[model samples]
Target: MKRIVFFLGKGGVGKTTSSAALSFYLSRNKKTTYWVSIDPAHNLSDIVHKDLHIKTQIDDFLFAEEVDVEGYLKNFLHETTNRMKEMYKYLQIVNLENMFDLLKHSPGMEEYALMYAMKEKIEENQDFEYIIVDTPPTGLMLKILSLPFSSKMWIEKLIRWRKRIISHRAAIANINPKKIDESLALTEEDDKVLKELGYQSEYVTFLIDLLSDKSKCKMVVVLNEDAMSLSESLKIKSGLNDLGLGLDFVILNKEGLGTVSNNIEKIFDLPTIRMPYLKNAMDTNTLANMGQRLAKIVE
Candidate 1:
């Protein structure tokens, strides 16, 4: 991907609006842009005055989607469970059907699903010049942002244990020739379990390297002039910092008669791209102007 920009902030802070504006701006510049909404709230349609459910072309250069997170999460679980069963028939005894229901509520399920949802989009839409994401609120965004590195660690450990198991099984088969080729792989090359883990390892590593690269990925926070939004933005920055990623810029989305206080720009210690309160966000003049301001960071 040429550039992937993520817009994140607290609820009601205009993350969707800022992201939509930037998408419009990029597309008008003739940069093929894929604007996706990962937030379960799914209000990107409200910005364009279009009822969007699937990937719909907004104009000549823009394609938009409101990801069905709930449905996608169910599919993600089903696909994951099926793959696991294929690799290990032993799991059949565990009542994977019931386990799937339980796994929905399991901790980190949403985060994992959201991470994979993003991965699917980025990998599938390689032809797009720019990929703009409107992320969920702060808490979930933080969890999702941290998942790649954490998942990589978990997979690495699993890979190590899998290799050890293969080595031990090979040793056992060598000791007793009668037990060789008993429907299980005795070598790393043939072990489906090891192969699966290796694939997951590589995928998560790709996410890690992609997000850590400033030239390709940009994390923009949208915030109003308020303590709560500012507080969340700070937490977002701290989380990104811990992950070896930085908040590239911020959009101070001003709405209504409220004038923006420049203190936010100083507080974040980064350039602020301001979006004036739009009386009619979908109006041609307003969007063109909004796109101009939001385009500063991307350009």
Candidate 2:
């Protein structure tokens, strides 16, 4: 299973920078790694100073495009609508098309589609040792990670219902062979895809371990050295612990002016990575240097 390390925090923090830096370091160390951007306003290309639409091989590792969530949602809706049409035709119903259209607009669609895409990527890419995720802001980040468990529960219930329907139809199949043929044909295809979703534990556990693993995978929270950022860091720590995940470290970005305080030290036990305030935003060379610095911190 691939490890997924997330660089997450509030907006304007150094999450994207840290993600690019970590990916650079991992790749430099000869790991076949991938850094995926889940942030809508993606800046991985800016940090890398190259377009990542195609896989760019840097040193021993490769970087690929961020998951296009809208594309995933479109694909998912098309497949699901096709399946619904097949079922409606089998049952000789035309009125359900409106219902199907409404179903496409339901809540949680984006999250579900993203989870499906992530699962597909993990299953397909066996060569990569690590999949570094540059997640969105804190609230949305938690929702994305929690999706697998929620989706798994929903899938299990649907599987049970499908089994029950199959059994119920089996009794009537002998009496109505033509109807049974159409019904079974449609359901068989659905079962094939649904079965693939059934075996999603590997992907889910990969994420769980990434969140929980202190040694190999770490959740590095980036924050400014201000009262609000410090408070948010405490909240993030509590939330991660509530979810059975541990914070590997807290990075105080742009904290050059502050003298070290006892209160800040007491709030967090893990080693802190302090980055000085830069007059200008980072360029590729600067980001690469930051990557080297982060490598030392992890080491």
Candidate 3:
């Protein structure tokens, strides 16, 4: 089983920073790890100050990639559209190009595409010991995390609807010899795709198990000392509990004066870690130092 860790919280709360530091530290221990950026506004390359997109191998044990969702979706749409065109010939439809364009513009398309890519990576990179995902901000993170369930439900509904439509079409075709077999064929093809989606959703159970496994997988929620962030973190913790996922720790980043010292004892009931605010901006050296500090928490 792969150990998957996600650094998630609101934007500008240092999730990217924590993710980079943790990935770096984990790599040092000779674990094969891939640090992935699932955020649209990717700063992973900026933080490392290197172009690490498209499966760049930084070291023997470490790799990184910034998922290009649009690029992936374009390729996926092209293939799907071609298949649609081929199948539509049976329905005697003059063109299916417009439908392809409409599908591209459909709601939740991007999310579904990205989830498909994630599922692909998990299967393709079986050699890696750990996969560290740097997710988008809170709301998007929630959507992405719950995608498997949503996608499954949507696909099932589509399948049922398509089956009903095909049955109706077949009845119409029996009376009128011009019965376009294309619509039924297209529905069958879509059913196959949805079947794959259902299988992938089931496969995601491994990821969920890895996340909920207290000893193997850990979720570290990074936040600041502000009240809003703290409250959000608490809600996130509760949400994870509702999903049957356990949060191993809450890391309070860039702690200000009196906050860590005063609140540290109170928060100690929860497995909490803190890092002091640095005067200068972060660099690789600074991140490595922060990683050292975090290692103590893990120890």
Candidate 4:
């Protein structure tokens, strides 16, 4: 029942529209749903025609929000720097504010911040029947999605090293009781660093399990009718496959195949959901109709 759907694709591929329509469909069916736009560009508010800059009730069961990705990123860095400073007293004289500025642009910062925000969201919002994520463009989103797996390995290694450090200290203390540093942990139980690494390992494991559980989580690729989009979509699939996660389906947004269906099926070897070109202006009714069409896939 972990209905978390991530709509991903190249930039300008209508990911927001596709995810929004699905939210409309599910909400109308009385399913408790949260439609979130994690894209930093913040198009969900304009697309949904509501002030979703804040989490807003769209209906009896649906909630919408355009996550402040930049704000969240800043807060994420602040908290991280603070924690590191506390753990390593040597950092106190190192001009943390300047370091914070540089770290803001550091590699993997956005992905880690977004992942942390997602962890917080999942932990806090447990009642929803669905949490539809409208992700950023392909490259960054792929990194964000696969972050837990990479983080798991790093945390595990850190834990092992911390344990060794604790064991070494205990051995030294045993040999010379007077030589022990009371400030340092001689046992694993008293080591805050080790305990933190353990918590991180456990959290990453939870994310890995959640992401690999296909029934609970689904990944959909949205694309245009061009060969470029299709090519990028394939890379997305390969990335997820590398992570041992399956791609549920492909949404050929602005499907232009006409009577020439099954091309997507042949390419992706998966079910293809077509959303035809929107000749008419976009509105709530159009989205609702599109959502209605998408409802069958969920059933």
What do the candidate models score in CA lDDT, each in turn?
0.83, 0.68, 0.70, 0.82
Q: Of the candidates shown, which would achieve the greatest lDDT relative to the real structure?
A: 1
Residue 80 in candidate 4, Cα distance off native in Å: 1.2
Can you write out model 4's per-residue Cα lDDT over 1-299, one digit (the tens) per residue?
Answer: 45888899999888988988898878877899998887888788886678887789977778998888888998988877787666665445677667687888899898898888777776566678888889999999999889999999889888888889889889999999778756777888888788778878887887888788777788999988887788899999999999999788898888764443458899899988889888652576678778876664565
lDDT of 1 by residue, 1-299 (tens): 68999998999988887888888878788899999988888888886767778888986799999888888899999988888778877545677667677887899898889888888877888789999999999999889889999889899889899899889888988899677658789879999988889888888887888898899899999888777887889999888999999998988777433534657777888888777677787664467557877776666
Q: List the candidates ranked by lDDT, beginning with the highest.
A: 1, 4, 3, 2
lDDT by residue for model 3 (1-299), tens: 35777787878888988887777776787778888887877888887667866888765578888888788788778876787666455555466768678879998777767766776676677678877788888777666667765555676677577677766766776788475644353344455444554565576655554455676566778888787677777777777776667566778888884343456436534667787787643575567667766664344
TM-score of every model versus the real structure: 0.93, 0.78, 0.78, 0.92
Against the hidden true structure, what lDDT does model 1 obtain? 0.83
Q: Pick the candidate with the highest TM-score.
A: 1
List residue ranges in candidate 4 displaced over 4 A. Answer: 90-99, 257-262
The TM-score between candidate 1 and the true structure equals: 0.93
In model 2, which runs have C-alpha deviations exceeding 4 angstroms? 1-3, 58-64, 94-104, 122-126, 168-216, 257-262, 296-299
- Cα deviation of 102, candidate 2, in Å: 2.8
TM-score of 3: 0.78
Q: Single out the weakest 10-residue window by summed lDDT for candidate 1.
A: 255-264
Model 3: lDDT of residue 11: 85
2 against 3, candidate with superior lDDT:
3
